[model samples]
Target: MIAWPPKAAPRIQPIGAERSAECAAIHAASFLHPWQEADFEQLFVGPGTVADGAIEEKEERLAGFIISRIAADEAEILTLAVAPNWRRRGVATQLLAPHLAALAVNRASSIFLEVEAENAAALALYANFGFEKVGERKSYYRAAGAEPKPALVMRRVLL
Candidate 1:
């Protein structure tokens, strides 16, 4: 008989103010302009905000996080970041699946987010989740000493 390895099952939980530092760290490592701890603290307690983290159970560390804010029937994803050591290993997928369900429960009819035009990996991930490009923002993102980059505005309707 052959033995197969068990699939990875990441634990998903609501991120609180205490973990704002950790989330900030991950965001800094993943993005050019990352939100600070204070920003995360507010989002954690904000009425329309949802913050979720993916935990690596054995190590007891955050693998990734996703944050979004909903207003009325619409939701907008603020950011999705994964720890450097956890990228390309399905952490984003695990984080997004439950996050989407949570958004639906919060009465979001559709979700919107913007991804840098050159971020092929993120674009692919969003596309896999059925997000379609609705518009583009010229020079929507800027970096120090570099030319600004465009961002794609994407939307996905919930069931």
Candidate 2:
């Protein structure tokens, strides 16, 4: 059987202004509708926003990232991306473990995220982390030359 988690774990660190371009590059490679560098800048400056990324130690490249915001006792994930080359190799888990811990430390009692219903990989990842489907938004995501896709709202209680 194949090893579930890779042996060489990714190096994770807090994402800052200096890493915005790298983050944008990884996001563009991962998603069809990618966030611009300016959008990442806005997120970096936003109140209560928290971001972290996984890096390839040898290549010094970003492999994945997670961004979220906390308000009161609740937190919501804005985006999560993993470079195509790094998918299914535990990069997302490395990014999420630290991000969730940070949110819990910040007194967040619950965390929420929206995932496209058809994204099996993301649904599995979130479910593995104890997230449960709480609601759904019909036609929440639109792609060029394709019909809108529904989004599943997932929640995890931290407290």
Candidate 3:
């Protein structure tokens, strides 16, 4: 029998205001435009929204996280990020598993998300998971003070 390497244990836990700072910092570092900590705080507290967070652990540090929400038979991937030190190690797959399963169970026939056209890695990841382009929202995001960037809308059918 081939001996498999030990896997790092990850925990999917509900996020609170306490970790908003770390989450925001990681979110900012991982994306061209990041949401403020206040935004996350509101998400966690906002009514009619369901969000879950995961922390990939090694010793005691947070390796990465993924956040999402389900609404009326549909779920949007609000954010999916892995810490720079922990990329390409299956952290994202683990984090997304629960949310995706739950969304499917909630009658989410299709899920949609928007990504920047220049973010090849993210686009590839979504495409690899069977998401297809459904539309485009031009100039959807801006880099702080720069001109807006085009957003590519993608969707995946689950049911």
Candidate 4:
């Protein structure tokens, strides 16, 4: 069974360029096409990049991280991943909740993302938070352990 982080005391912190390597490692373990260190480095320095990490108190290790950027009236979730060992905890919720709230505070009209169509767990998570399918990209992602898969494009309008 997949073990999850303890839910009661998880914490979230802004992730900076210093932790790019660690973030890259976690991304590698948790994703099929994880971003490289250089990619995160660019993101940290890029015009609209914003990112955060979820950590358990005392250990200071990354339980999950979310990468997003605000562009005008929209916020895009570029990537969000939880360590395989940390799946099912409230870590993803913790990481995304504040970011989405912040975007709403900034008057963001909506948020959008693309995920592999077969990622049921992610689709459910996003759906629970009110994201809806807006479109699709054919063969958008390389499957977890197989060839590429179709991508579902989803969006959530801030109200």
Candidate 5:
């Protein structure tokens, strides 16, 4: 029997230092090189930084998260990840909405994020949200045992 996707929408909430371990776990499952809990802790304590997680209440698990830093009139998404089982289920979208809204409310004029050039799903998601390619970083991601990959910088005007 095929298992249907969860019917209940995941709740989006602010993520605190207490949830760093959970965020690290999800990051490990989502990325080739994951951020550690300590890294998340640093981000939590940083000024102008914000993070949100998508919590699946029934399972009591964090399905996805997005972290960003707002400085002056600009914001930058530092990282975004979704649990493997939660991909293609709107978890990332849910996590991003409120963070973007908060940035806009704070008077941010634009938001920027870097995505691996080959990540089609992320490219599509950003495009759907009106993000446009603005720049490229050469060999921005160096995963172990693989060739370094290029990163595309995408931007969206919030004002």
Candidate 6:
């Protein structure tokens, strides 16, 4: 989730309902429990939803994407995913920087997200960006053959 940016800078672009298929593809490839294309499409058109994708300029492919929902002065990051090939290359950092600014512009004073408790890289990245430990959701992530990792809810003051 905290993938560093690579040598080539990714171009950040608004992702609308039309790109739900591509978003679903990345989500399926990245998560154990992936949200479907319909889910992405719904979110894309949902009230207060904001979505963006990081595109690799070199290949003209999506490197990663982030989606969030804003309600009043608060916001929550729905998902942040990086393509397998783009992991550890800093796409998350690049995507989040501009996204946070947009949230502030939208008058969001605080933002939140949930991540696996064991995801050190993501925790570190969030911490670096001023997010703090908030609450936890037990067994938030589960697999058919594996134990679940608790989800840590983190919050950051954006404005």
4 or 6, which is superior by lDDT?
Answer: 6
User: Of the pair 1 and 4, which is ahead by lDDT?
Assistant: 1
What is the per-residue lDDT of model 2 for residues 42-128, given as tens digits with 9 covering 90 to 100? Answer: 899999998998878887778788999999999999999988777778788888988999999999999999999999989999999
Q: lDDT for every model? A: 0.90, 0.89, 0.73, 0.83, 0.88, 0.89
lDDT digits (tens) for residues 18-121 of candidate 5? 88999999889878888899999999999898788888889778888898999999999998988888887887777777889988987889999999999998
Colliding pairs, model 5: none
**TM-scores, each model vs. reference:** 0.93, 0.93, 0.81, 0.89, 0.93, 0.91
Please give the ranking of all candidate structures by lDDT, highest first, separated by commas: 1, 2, 6, 5, 4, 3
TM-score for candidate 1, please give it.
0.93
Question: Which 10 successive residues of model 2 have the least lDDT summed?
Answer: 1-10
Residue 91, candidate 1: alpha-carbon lDDT: 78
Worst 10 residues of 4 by lDDT: 1-10
Clashing pairs in 6: 3-90, 4-89, 4-90, 5-89, 5-90
C-alpha RMSD (angstroms) for model 4: 2.4
Candidate number with the higher lDDT (2 or 6): 2
lDDT of 3 at 95: 67
lDDT of 1 by residue, 15-117 (tens): 8788899999999999999899998998889889987899888877888999999999999999999898777778788889989999999999999999999
The TM-score measured for candidate 3 stands at: 0.81
What's every prediction's RMSD, in angstroms? 3.6, 2.1, 4.0, 2.4, 2.2, 2.6
Query: Residue by residue across 73-96, what tens digits does model 6's lDDT show?
Result: 999999999888778877888889
For model 2, the stretches where C-alpha displacement exceeds 4 angstroms are: 1-7
Candidate 1 residue spans exceeding 4 A from truth: 1-8
Model 4 lDDT tens row, 28-139: 9978677899888889888777788887676778888898888998989999988877788767877888878877887778999999898898998899889999999987
